[model samples]
Target: MLEASLKTQMQSYMERISQPIEITANLDSGAKSQELRELLQEIAAMSDRITLVEGSDDAQRKPSFTIARTGTDISVTFAGIPMGHEFTSLVLALLQVGGHPIKLDEAVIEQIRNLDGDYNFETYFSLSCQNCPDVVQALNVMSIINPRIRHVAIDGALYQSEVDERQIMSVPTIYLNGEKFGQGRSSVEEILAQLDSGAGARKAEALNAKEPFDVLIVGGGPAGAAAAVYAARKGIRTGVVAERFGGQVLDTMAIENFISVKETEGPRFAAALEEHVKAYDVDIMNVQRATKLVTGGNLVEVQLESGATLKGKTVILATGARWREINVPGEQEYRNAGVAYCPHCDGPLFKGKRVAVIGGGNSGVEAAIDLAGVVAHVTLIEFGDELRADAVLQRKLRSLPNVDIIVSAQTTEIHGDGKKVNGLSYTDRKSGESRKVELEGVFIQIGLVPNTEWLKDTVSLTRYGEIEVDAKGQTSIPGVFAAGDVTTVPYKQIIIACGDGAKAALGAFDHLIRSSVDMPAEAETATA
Candidate 1:
C-alpha cells in the first residue's frame, strides 16, 4: 500500500479520471487477503476511474487476491502484498496500464515495439535492495507499450523456494523468458540493447567494425564523460569504450557532495553525464569493456572484451572503482536483504532501525555518520584498537548519542531471518571473545577496489593497483593517460574525478599537438 502523499502524486499524474481497464480482485479467506482487499478498496475509491471486481470464493486462482486488467490478463499480481520498494513498482504499473507514457527514450521504445517474440521477465529482489527499483521499472515500462512483455518482481524474502530453484544469490536477478538475463544494477539502455538484439547471458554486443579516433576513452563514467566532452571541444575524433557508461556512480544513492548542484541521485546524474557527452560529436561505444591496451607503437589499440579493437593516437583511462566486499558467510546471500555497501544508497530503508558499520576507517566512519541521521542507532565495529578516521570526523561521530564505537572487533557473520538480515556476530580481536548485535542492516565501507586489473603490464600501476598518474593524468606510457578513482588521486570524490578527467583530456590534446599531427597553429604555440 502507498502513503497518502504518493497516492496524491499518482492521482495528479494520471491523464484522465477514467477506468481504462477493469480490475478483478480474487480474494481468499486468508488474513493477508483481507488486508489487501482493504488496500485495493481504498485505491478503487480514489476516483471513479478505478473499477474493481472481486472474484468469487471458488475462483480458480490459488492466490488470495489477484488483480489484473479484465480481458488482457496483464496484471501486477502481488500474491504476498507488494510492500516496501515493490509498492512503488505496483503504483507505477497501475499508471502505465492507464496509458501514462513511460517517458523512455524514443529509440528504446521503438526497439521494444519491434520485438518479434513475447518476453516474460521475472525479477527477484529484496525489499532493501536500492538497485532493484530501476531494473523492475525498466521491464515494467517495456510491458506497458509491448503487451507481449510481462514482468513480475518477486520479493526474495517471501519466495525462498523460487530463490533456491533459480540459484539467486544477489538482488535484482532478472530472468527473461524463463532464462537468466542480467544481474546487478543495469541501465535501461543496456537492458534495451540486450532485448532488441536477443543477447543471452553474455556481455553487450561488439562493434560492427573497427574504428579509429584521435583520442579513445576506455571507461565511460563521469570522468570519461568529462574527458570526452573536453576532447570533442578540441574538434578531435573522440570515442568512448565502456561496458556501461556511468561506472560506479550508478551505485551511489544521493550525491550531496557534488559541487554547485544542491543534490542529485546516482541514476539521474549518470544519465545527465551521458546526455552531456552525447551532445558533442563523440562516438559512444556503449556496453563494451576494454580488456587490453596496446601502447607499444605510435597507434594505441584498445582490445575490448567484446572482441572489437579500437585504434587511437592517444588513450584516456577512466575505468572507475568498485566497493570491496565483506566476504563473510551470508554476506553475499543476503546482500540486498540488509547488507548494503553505499550508505547513501540504501540507508533510508533501515529508518529507525539499528545497523552496524564494518570498518572503522574514514569511509566506515562516514557511512556510520550518514546512517545515524536516518536510522535509529549505529554500531561501528573496527578490527584495530583505534579508529583510523580523521580526528575531526572521530569527534563528530562521538558527538552523536545514538552511535556506539567498538574497537578491536572483527565481523564474523551476517545473521538474517531466512530472507532479510536481522543481526550480526563478531569477535573481540583483543579478548578473543565473540558477541552478537541484533540489527536490521549492516553497511560495509572497507575501501574501494579500482577497476584497473585489465591494464596490467600495459602501463605503470601503483603497488596498490591504482594507475600511476602525474598531475596532468599521464600514465607511464606516453599518450596513455589515466584519471578518476583508478588513478593515484588523493581522494575519490566525483568532483575531483571530473576535474582529473578534464585534465587528462587536455593532456591528450597537448600530446596530439606536440606530436605535430594535424595540429592547429594556436594549439602548438600554446603548448610551446
Candidate 2:
C-alpha cells in the first residue's frame, strides 16, 4: 500500500513537470509554440519581469526560462549548450535580465535618456582577448543607461559569416547602426558623444539644418590629437573624431621612455594630451567616426556614419595601431580584472598583484623587468628557445629579483574565478610537461598592427599595411598626410610617434599657409 501511494505521488509530480512553463522561445521556424507563448504573455502581463526575446537556431523548441524583469530582478537560461567563452555570454545574459546597470555616471545617464531617436551600436571582439572586456562593459553600460541605444555584441569566432559580410578582420570593431565607427576599446564619454552627435544629426535632418565642421579628423591618438590642435591653432575650422580619444596610448603599460617626461602612464599621458587639445577652439568630436570620405574640386566632403557630413580643405589620417592578441582561453574572461596588455595602463592597478608576461621579444622582457618592481611576482613565459630582444635588455631582465623566465613555454589557458583572474596553465615544449602558475594578471607584449586600412584607398601602404610617408610625414597624396605607427617610420616607440605627429602638424601648417597664398581669388575672398 505504501509503494502504491509513492507511485501515485511520483505520477502526479511527473504530470506537473510535463506542463509547459512560462518561458517562450522564438525560433527560426517562424512559428511560436502557442502554449509557451501564451504562458510568457501571462508572465509579461504581471509587473514581475521584462520579456526578452533571445535569438536561437532552433525555433520549434520552447525557451529555457520565463525571464522576469521586476525592477532589478531578472533571470535567463540558454536552450543550447554553453561552453568556453559562451559561458561569459550566459553570465552577461543573466546580468541583462537582472537589469543591473554597470556603474555609470548619472550625467551620462541623463544625456542618453534625453536622446529620442534610435541609436544602434554593434561591436566586434575576439574570444581570446583580455582588453576587449572593458570595451564590451562600457557599451553594455551605455545600453542600460538609455533604451534608445541598442548594444549588439558580435563574436568574431562564431560569427565568421557576419564578419566576412562586414569586412571585420579585427576585434572590437564598433559600428553605429550600419556604419563602421571605430575599433578597439572605447570610453563612456567617447561613446556618449557619438550617440549625441548621431541624435543631433537626425534632428537636423528633420529641420534641414546645415552640417557642422569644415574638416573632420578620424583618429584622436597622439598624432590625430596633435593634428586637431595644430589645425585649430592655424585658425582653420576643424573637428576631431575618434572612437576613443587616447587611442593605443591608453593601453600602454608605461611611458618611461617618452621624451621630456621621466616617467608616465598611458592614461595619464593621454589625459594631459587630451586636455591640451580640448583647450583649443576646435570642435572635439570624441568617440565618433568618419565612415566615408569624398574629395571634390575645392572641398573634401566627409560623411560620418552617424548621418552627419562635413566639408574640409584637406584630410589628415592619424589613426594609430593596436596590440596583437595572444590567443588563449580565459584571457578574454578576466582581461581588465587581471589579464592586461598595456602594463603602463593596468600595471599600477595590479600593484602587489602576481602577474605574468607573455612573449620573449623586447617588449615582453621589458614588461617583465618593469612589472617586477611593482608586482609581487613576475613570471615571463616565452614560446621561443631564446629571447629575441637586445642582449642588454635580456641580461637586465635575467638579473631582476622577482622575474622568472621560462623558455619554450606556451600559454594554454587562463584560470580564474568569474570575477577576477587567479592563475594560468601552460605547456613546456622542450620538456613536454604541463605547468600551472598562480598569477593575478597576464600582459601580452607580442606586437602591434597599424591602423591603416581606412587609408588603403588614399595612400600607398607597405606589405605590412603601414602607410609610406616621406621624411616630413607627408603621404604620396599631396593634401593628405600620415603619421605615427600608421606610417613606415622604422620605430614603433611612443617618442617616435610624438615626433612624427609634431612633424606632420608642422607639415600641415606649411601646406595650409601655402594654399592660402595660392588659392583662387574667390576662395581667398571667401576666407577674407
Candidate 3:
C-alpha cells in the first residue's frame, strides 16, 4: 500500500484523467491477494473516474489485475504487486489507462499503433531490479497504444515456480508468445526493432540522410550529455548517437558520489541528464551503435552497426565502459542462467542459494556483503594475495556470518548443467591446487573495460584500449576528442565524466575556431 504522501501525490496525478478507467482484479484469498486488494482499493479511492471491479477467479495468476479504459481492450496487467522500482510503472499504467497522454515521440507512437502482428509479451522482473521497470513501462505503453498488443509484467520472485521451470536467472527476461524474446533492459525503439524486422533498416536510412553536425557525440552517458548541452548552448548544430542513452550508467545502481545530488538511482539520474540535454537544441538518436570512425574526410564520419554513416565537423567520443567479464568456460554459456554481472540487480533471484563473487576489491567485497543478506551463502574469490577493499568494507564483510573470503584464488571455469550454473572451479595461487565451489550463481565484480574497440586502428590507444587524451581531452586525431571512461582520465566516476565531457566540448570548440582561423583568406571566402 502507498504511504500518505504517496497517496496525496497519486490523487494529484489522477486529477489529470478525463476518461473512465476500470481496475479488474483476479485475486484469491491468500495474504498476498488480500494485500493487493487493499492496495487496489486505496488506488480506486483517489479519483472519481477510477473504479474497482471484482472479476472472476479463473485467472491463471493470483493477485493479478488489469487496468483498462472503460469498454476498450486497451489494457496492461501486473501479475504481482508493482512496487519498489515498478512503482512508477503502476502509476504510469493508471494515468495512461485513464486517458492521460504518454510522453513519447509522435513517430514512435504511430509506429506502435501501426504494428501488424499479434504481440503477447510477458516480462519476468524482480522488484529490486533497476532495469525491469523500463521494459515493463515500454511494453505497457505499447499495449495501450495498440490493442492487438498485450503485455503482462510478472514478478519473478512472487512466481518462483514459473521462474524455476523456465530456468530464469536474470531480471527483465522478456518472452514473446511463450518463447524467449530478450534477456535485459530494452527501450520502446529496441522492442519495436525486434518485433518489426525492417525498423532497423528504416532507422539506418533516416540516420544516413541527416545533415552533418558541428559537434556529434558518440555516446549518451553523463559525459556525452554534458558535451551535447555545452555545444548546443554555443549556437552550433549538435547531435548525439548512442547505442543506448545512459551507457554504463544505466547498469549502475546507487550513485551517492555525484556532487550536489544527495542520492539518486542510475535510471533516474540518466533520465534527468537526458531531460537536461533535451532542453537545448541537441538532437539525440538513441540505440545507435558506432562501429567505425573515419577521420580522413573534412567531416569526420562515424559508421554505425546499422550501416549508417554520421558526419560531423568535430566528434567527441564518450563511448564509456562496460563490466569486465571473466572469459572462462561456461561463463558465457550460463550468462543469465546463474552467471550475472550485477549483484544488486540479480542477487534477489538467488535467494537462499549459494553464490560466488569474483574479485576482492571494493565492488566484490561490497557485493558479497550485500548478497550475504539475501543469499544463503557468499564466497568471495580474489585473484590477488589479499583483499584490496577499503578497511571499513573489509570490516563489514568480515562481520557477515554467511560470507567467506578467499584470497589468491583465480576463477578458472563456471560449471553448469547446460541450463543453469551449479558450481565453479578455481585455483589457489599459493598451493596451485584446484578447488570448486558448489554454488547456484557467480557474480563478476571486476573493473570496467573501455568501449574503445571500434577505435582500435583509428585512434591512438593505450595498451588497455583506453583512448589517449591530453589535458583538454583531445585525442591523437585532430578535431576528434575523447572523454569519460573511454579516455585516459584518472577516475571513472559520473561527476568526473561530466567534467571531462565539458572539457572535451570546449577543446573541440577551440580546435574548430583555430582551424577556421588558420584557413587562407581565399579558402575562407570560398567556404563562406
Candidate 4:
C-alpha cells in the first residue's frame, strides 16, 4: 500500500506533461507485474495528459513497458518491473518523453553521436547506492537523445541468475555491449571517453614508463594524498596509484565529525582532498589497481593490473578497508533497492522510513544508533546470543526508543518485491522458528577487510592481514611506510588516517635522510 505522504512527494516530482505521453504496458497478472502495473497506473492517473494502454502479455516477451511521445516512434523501454531505485528512472523517462530537454554538454553530445554501431548500456544498480542515480540518469538521457544508444537499468537483486552469469560483484556496474565498462561511480565525461576509446574490455593502460619516483603512494584516500603532498613538498619526484581517487570517503556521506569544517559531504570532501594534493607536483594515476608488490631491491616495484610497473625509492601503502558483505540471498540484487552497506551514504535517503541492521557487532549497533535518529524505526539483528559491542555503545543503542535488538538470530534471506526490499527473514536460534520483519531497507556492518592482499608477500602483516607498522608509520621493511585502515592503526577514522598519512610521509623522508644521506666528513675522509 502506498502512503499519502509518499504519494504527495511523487506528485511534486512529477512535472506537468506538455505533449501526450503514452505508456504501453505489456504485462501479465503475475504478482511482480501487477504491482508494477498498479504503480504505473497510479503515476498516469496523476496527470491527465498521460495515456496508459494495456497490451496482452506474450510468453516470449517479458513484462515490458514503452514510454514514447504520442506521434513519434522514438522511445525507451523497461524490459521488466521498474521498482526500488529504478522507480526514479521510469519517472525521468516519462518526463523526457513529455518534451523535457536532455540537459547535456555539447561536447558530450558530440561524443555520444560519434559512437559507432549500437551501444547498449546495461547498468546494474541498487536503489540505495548514492551515486547510482546519477549514472542511471546519464544513461537514460543518452538513450533518449541518441537513437543508436539504448540503455537499461537492471535491479540486480531481482535477477540473481543474470548477475551470476555476468559476474557483477558490486553495484553501479555499467556494461557496455555486455562488457564491463566501469564499476563504482563514473562521470558522464569519463564514460564517454571509455566508449570512444573502447575501454570496456578492461584494457591495460601504461603507468610510469620513464624515471622512477623517490616516493610512490599506493592508494588515493586521505592517507595516500597526505603522503603524496608531504613527499612532494620535499622536492622529490612523487607518484600515486589509485583504483579510485576517493577511496572509502566516496561511500561516506556526512562529515560532522571531521574537525574544522562544520559540515560537508563525501564527494565534495574528496574533491577538496584532490585539490590539496594537486597543488604540488604529484603524479596521480587514477583508476589503477595494484596487483602485486616487490620489495628488497634498490627500487621497489609495484605491479598494476594493467601489467605496467611503478618503481619507487620508497613506497607508502594506504589502501583503505572495505566493508564485509553478508553474501545472503537478495542482498546483492536489492542493493540500494533496500539492501544498503554504508549508513552515512544511504541513511538520509530513507528518512522517516523503517530499516534493519544485520550483525550484532559494534559496527552494526553503531549503524542502528545512527540511523534511529534519521529513520522512523530501527531493527538490529545479531547471529550471536548477545551484542558484541561495548557497553557504552549498547547503552546508547538502548537509549534510543525506536530501536529494537534481536540477538540469537540468523538472517536467513533478504526479501524484496523485485525492486526494493520489503522485509527480511531471520530464524530465531532458540525456537528454531523463522521470523520476518517488515522494513524498507537493510544495512550491513559486519566488519572490514584491509586492502593489503597484494602487499602480504612483500611486507610483514599481522594475523588479521593488516600491514604491520611502527609508531612513526614505518613498515617492517625499510624504505616502506604504511598508513590508514589497511595498516595497524588504533582506530580507523578520517582525521586519524590523515594524521597517519602525514606521519608515514614524514617517516619515508626520514628514511631517505638516514639511509641515503652522505656519511659524516670524518668517516668520508677516513675511507678516502
TM-score for every candidate vs. truth?
0.74, 0.54, 0.97, 0.63
Candidate 2 structure, TM-score to reference: 0.54
How do the residues 66-131 of candidate 4 rate in per-residue lDDT, one tens digit apiece? Answer: 787798755777656665556667777888877776666585676677778788888877555656
lDDT of 1 by residue, 1-528 (tens): 658897787667544533365556766777666777777777777656677778777753324343355466555544455666566766776776765567766866887777888888887776655577778777777776677887777666556667666655456778888898887777666787676655422333335354568899989898999999999888778899888888887877679988899998776788899999989889887777778888778789988765667899999999989888878897987886788777755665566789999998988998999889988999999989899999999999999999999999989999997888889999999889999999988899998888888888878888888999898999999999989999999888999999999999999998997785686554344421
Error of 2 at 97 (Å): 34
How well does candidate 1 score on lDDT at residue 20? 62
Estimate the overall C-alpha local distance difference test score of candidate 2.
0.64
For candidate 3, the lDDT comes to: 0.92
**Where does model 3 exceed 4 Å of error?**
517-528
Alpha-carbon deviation at 346 in model 3, angstroms:
1.3
Q: What's the lDDT of the predicted structure labeled candidate 1? A: 0.78
lDDT per model, in order?
Answer: 0.78, 0.64, 0.92, 0.79
Candidate 1: worst-modelled 10 consecutive residues by lDDT: 199-208
Task: Arrange candidates, best TM-score first.
Answer: 3, 1, 4, 2
Which segments of model 4 are wrong by more than 4 Å?
1-114, 117-129, 133-184, 187-205, 327-339, 343-355, 361-363, 366-378, 383-403, 410-441, 516-528
Question: Which model, 1 or 2, shows the larger TM-score?
Answer: 1
